[model samples]
Target: MCIENKYPHAETTRIENTLGQRPKMFEIDMLVPNGDAFEIKWRDATTDGDHITKEHTRLKVIANAGYHPIRVMFYYPQREQARRIQKTLETLYAGVGGHYYFGDSAWQYVRDYTEVDLLAVLNRIASEKTHGE
Candidate 1:
């Protein structure tokens, strides 16, 4: 989902000075409803330094705000790179509850599966303040 915010009464001076009339700060490619966020890089995988850097920055901001943030790098139409990214995400979030999947299917299966819906699982976890069966 794309969220667009028009300039109304919120810091036109700063926006003009920093962005020089650019309308977008950043485009969030995909947001998983359970709170995991992702930015996709489909092609031109050779030039992903900027994308990865920005994704980590966003993740840090969200984490500092006390929310779980996950960065998913998608190399769509490139199966080899996608698999590599999948492995990386799995290893990175191995022991963390909020870090799994990051909206990707391959790494998602690395975690244990319950027959419950995501919300149900999340609610149970929240109530218990713990993960695992």
Candidate 2:
């Protein structure tokens, strides 16, 4: 919502996925037209090892479409398995010349890219809820 509100032109893009046996389409999150592809995640706690491969394939598809792939994960996983997966994903992103932002960096990326202070907005919402405004 924030991205759409800030950049009304930003839209989800569908790309062909040839990694699977049968070609299908993959919907990318918040793809800015003629700009980088942004994949925003609130959290990734998946311990499944296959997740890394899936992400790699998705990144390749995004890049193949001539867009730089950028991943922004707001929350860092606490579990060991999940952490390993994140670490692996981070490495994969780097290997593919993609950008990965986790935790504070992720928030900063959103703020800088969108020119919006997400923390301040979130705080205001919290205050409104508390005061029943």
Candidate 3:
């Protein structure tokens, strides 16, 4: 794992917290030496998946290990799916002592306030699509 330039002095590490007695280890996405960790959930992370059962344990392992883990859930363009996942993710993240973040795109999650101009972004994307056409 590489040290993030912002956290240069902090070594990055990965932890394998097994999903169950079956010995399936779920790898943590990222962790910093200074006790900051991040675990990501991709598209359609509704509570119905097989791995969903083990998510709480995974988060507990990270937090119990002394890191302030954050759970970032990716967003979908589809409104219903996105809303469902966002609601579920927020509920889980709160239960496990981690921060919850979700966005229409990854940029929205990381950007500081006042920089999220969705209209401008959509317009630029539309213009690019026109070029391809």
Candidate 4:
């Protein structure tokens, strides 16, 4: 089965296999083959306004899907809040079987898990800017 988010919020792919009546589908934020199922929370998505406990629910869904759901807190200029956010994400990830990252280190963790060449992408952007491309 093919899963696509196409939702304003985070996306999950509906992985499935035919069983009895229909296919068993799992909606995970991101399920990389033998890698990680990721749930990215930007800003104060966890405790902002009425969003308290929302992240927890999302992570739970991933876990119920039989995937290790990783929660990544994305906080940039608000580095001071990173410490608090990291604590929250860590606590949740600990309860689950996945992992988490915050602050400047967030991108690094995601890159490692997703196996994306972030440095190369950034270098290409820099080169283009330098060469006015």
RMSD, every candidate, angstroms: 13.0, 1.6, 5.3, 8.1
Candidate 3 Cα outliers beyond 4 Å, as residue runs: 1-3, 9-12, 41-47, 77-86, 104-109, 112-133
Cα lDDT listed for each candidate: 0.39, 0.84, 0.59, 0.57
What TM-score against the true fold does each predicted structure earn?
Answer: 0.34, 0.90, 0.60, 0.58
- Measured on C-alpha atoms, candidate 4 has an lDDT of 0.57
For model 2 the local lDDT of residue 116 reads 85
Residue 19 lDDT in candidate 2: 68
Among the numbered candidates, top lDDT falls to 2
Which candidate ranks first by TM-score, i.e. highest?
A: 2
Q: Measured by TM-score, how close is model 1 to the native structure?
A: 0.34
RMSD of 4: 8.1
- Measured on C-alpha atoms, candidate 3 has an lDDT of 0.59
**Candidate 2 pairs with clashing backbones:** none
Clashes of each: 0, 0, 0, 1
Q: How much is the lDDT of residue 59 in candidate 1?
A: 45
Error of 1 at 13 (Å): 22
Q: Enumerate residue pairs that collide in model 4.
A: 3-14
Model 4 off-target regions past 4 Å?
1-11, 14-27, 41-49, 73-83
Worst 10 residues of 3 by lDDT: 110-119
Model 2 per-residue lDDT at 93 = 81
